[model samples]
Target: MKYVIILGDGMADEPIEELGGKTPLEYARTPVMDDLAGRSEVGLACTIPQGMKPGSDTANLAVLGCNPRQYYTGRSPLEALSIGVDMKEGDIAIRTNLVTLSEEEEAYEDKRILDHSSDEISTEDAAVLLEAVRKELEEDAYHFYVGTSYRHLLIWSKGSVTELTPPHDVLGQRAGDHLPAEEKLRAMQKKSYEILSKHPINLERKAKGLNPANSCWFWGAGTRPSLPSFEGKYHKKGAMISAVDLLKGIAVGTGMANIHVEGANGGLHTNYEGKAQAAADALLKDGFDFVYVHVEAPDEMGHQGSVEKKVQAIEYLDERVICPIREALDKAKEPYRLLVLPDHPTPIRVRTHTSDPIPYLLYDSEKELRRIGAYNEREARISGILVEQGYELIRKLFEN
Candidate 1:
């Protein structure tokens, strides 16, 4: 039987006053997911382990059946793998985000963090800006590699896993308060701001009323990780379809195929239909037994605190990604087991990931459940089926 997992990153959210006390998932028009829930095993899966920070790196790893407690190392190492950076033992990888800082008439310590993603800047522009930083920062021990827009990588040879704050976690807060405690890393961050703020690309962005990719905020550090192959674990060929380097990296390290959809990007305006087409092709035509599809829009919109946009993202996922893949699998006459869920909740109020169990729908096309249901978080709560170990949920999906 074929298997597929659809993950809407940070899709679960708390009820917002703007949403009339309903989470974005409940208010969104997710007809496809809602329909599937009626015939699926609706439940809650705790993707983030207890005492673990609620990050997509940990949650997605668990959802893929890799226990983050056992196999997780750090977020940046997985991303390094996706970007083809062969990390040596003791080598540290850090997530370097090209963030925007407020240009207020105040000291740098008083300046607020305006944006974590710089308005989801284009990768082409981001690459150029990163090149400028690379010229300044690259040393024998440190090298900057450009990943997707706003998301970049820094390899610090023999570097320690320094604790640093994720820029998104401190949005609209004074940058100085959250600066890294490590002296060298903190100094480098300041130097990055100095170099990036004067670059022509940022100047042009400023002239166009766009957020400048002004500073490189470093965080999400760790040594390399080791994950067993997906095929070895599940005994089924698997493919991952996502625009996020972190997900792609996890697939790479797990011996799964990373399917790159041409127009796919990790943002609200990314290519949803293309990602759906890629997953469908992997299952129907490419002979893969399992496929994982991840969408970033829901999480990104949540971070931006846009209730309307978050709802729109969910509707778009249901319409463009989920529906198209379902149609393809149906047309191909494939008997498939489908799982739909979120890694964690990036509530609109918090604008960051939370350690909350997300609702999931597991559907088997051949053996349909006759329970009436809707696919949102509240409905899953009503179902009363809970999987405490999120990694084990994949076993349930793959088991006959």
Candidate 2:
């Protein structure tokens, strides 16, 4: 049987009183998910283990059945792999975000972090900004590589993974409090601001009332990654469809094919229909054993604390992605086992990833479980089926 996983990143959320006390998933019209939940084995899975930060890097690894405790190297290394950057053992990979800081007459540290994603600046514009940073900051050791949107990469030859805060984690906080303690990294960051703040591009963005990607904030650093081959472990020829480099990097390191869909940006307006079509083609036309489709919009909206947009994103996932793929599989007579879930909760309250137990649904086309409740956190919790080891949950999809 073929296998599929439609991962809605950061879809899970705590109940919001504004939405009639219902979470986004609870309020969103997810008819396909509701119907699938009726015939699917629904329950909660702890995708993030205790003592581990609830970054998508660790959580998605668990969803794919790779124990993060053993396999995860660092978040940036995975994105580096996705970018085809061959890193040596001593090379440290760090994620660099072109962020926006409030303009004020205080110390650089006193500037409040206005935006982590620089208002989700276009990659085309971000590339120009990064090029400026590279010319000004590149040295014998540290070099910058342009990635998608505000998310970029930096390779520090024989560098250290010192303490640095994720930009998203400290939204609206004083920049000084979270700046890297390491002198060299801090110096580079300061230089990046100087290089970008007055660039012609920032002036253009300012004129248009857009958040200028004024500063470079770095985090999620680590050495090179070495993951066990997914084919060797699962014996399935798998493919990954995602716009995020981190997921693509994981697929690359694990030897899974990366299916790039045109117009598939990892944002609210990302090409949802294109991603669904790609997964269907990879499974039916290409004859892959498994396909994983990850949608990043929901998580992104959650991080922005935009409940309305998060609900809209969930609706698009159910309609544009899930419904089309399900119909394609059915029409093609491709009997498949499908699993649907979020990597973790980016609760609106905190606007960041949390270690809370997210819900999961596993549907076997051959033998319908026909269980209770819709596909959501509350309903899944009511099922009372908890998978303590989230990494083992993928095995359930392949099991007979």
Best by lDDT: 2
TM-score of each: 0.99, 0.99
Candidate 2 local distance difference test against the native: 0.93
* True-vs-predicted CA distance for residue 76, candidate 1, Å: 0.2
lDDT for each residue of candidate 2 in 1-400, tens digit (9 for 90 to 100): 8999999999999999999999999999999999999999999999888999999999999998899999888899999999888899799999999999987777787889988888899999999999999998999898899899999999999888887799888898899899898899998998888788888999999999999999999999998888989999999999999999999999999999999999998999999999999999999999799999999999999989899999999999999999999999999887999999999999999988999999999998898876668989999999989999999999899998
Give the per-residue lDDT of model 1 (tens digit) for 1-400: 7999999999999988877888999999888999999999999999999999999999999999999999998999999999999999879999999999987677667889989999999899999999988898789999899899899999999989877899988999999999989888888888888899889999999999999999999999999998999999789999999999999999999999999898788887889999999999899888999999999999999899889899999999999999999999989899999999999999999898899899999999999898886899999999989999999999889887
Clashes of 1: 0
Which residue pairs in candidate 2 have backbone atoms (N, alpha carbon, C) closer than 3 angstroms, thus clashing? Answer: 109-176
TM value for model 2: 0.99
Off by over 4 Å in 1: none
Clashing pairs in 1: none
**Model 2 spans with C-alpha error above 4 angstroms:** none
Model 1 TM-score on a 0 to 1 scale = 0.99
Candidate 2, run of 10 with poorest lDDT: 102-111
